[model samples]
Target: MIHEHEWQQWQQQSANHAATAAFLLLDVQTNLTMLETLQAALDKIRANPAAEPYSLSGNSYFIQLQPHRVLIEELYGDDYAEPVTLSLDDFGDALAYWHTQI
Candidate 1:
């Protein structure tokens, strides 16, 4: 499980991108395959070009994807939150990092 400090540190890291954040969070929270989450995020973006920064919310986290970047936000209580933004390349790096972790 991810601790609060680790989550906060991730948000501060300039290297952490959208795909990395999504995969890490999902891996901890569910048994779904990583490809499933990646495909879902891509599908959401392709299905709604107008929603450039489209978002998907899970029980405790949310991810917003844009053409060149992505944002991952972790929700706490009713209003508290932590968010991180990443470029496409950084996001790819993040995905690779998580894959290794698994």
Candidate 2:
């Protein structure tokens, strides 16, 4: 469940990049659990490199999980845009940074 403190932390988090902005704007109910879900997807890919990629909608963005990496695409209502690639390790680092900031 989402906590007020967490939401407050998010409010103080940076949105300096497009990908970060997308993550920040995700719908709290269905998409705020992205870190866990993305980590799980990273594990799945690591377990089987041949595993098919999967795409999950984060209400306002789409995360496409591939082997060792993810593609983040911001969405506007029904429209989708180009995806930005991010290694799972890099995403972990980003999370770590956010944690430190909070």
TM-score for candidate 2, please give it. 0.57
In candidate 2, stretches whose alpha carbon ends up further than 4 angstroms from where it belongs are: 1-21, 24-34, 77-81, 95-102
Inter-residue clash pairs, candidate 1: none
Q: Residue 58 of model 2: what lDDT?
A: 60
Tell me how many residue pairs clash in candidate 2: 0
Q: Please, what is the TM-score per model?
A: 0.52, 0.57
Candidate 1 deviant stretches above 4 angstroms: 1-32, 39-54
Query: In TM-score terms, which candidate is top?
Result: 2
lDDT of 2 by residue, 1-102 (tens): 234456455434433244753574453233435556655776788789799997777667777778778777776655555667776665555454444434
The candidate scoring highest on lDDT is: 2
Per-residue alpha-carbon lDDT of candidate 1 for residues 12-64, written as tens digits (9 for 90 to 100): 56534433565466543343374456546655665675655666666656667
Displacement of the residue 23 alpha carbon in candidate 1, Å: 6.4
Question: What do the candidate models score in CA lDDT, each in turn?
Answer: 0.57, 0.59
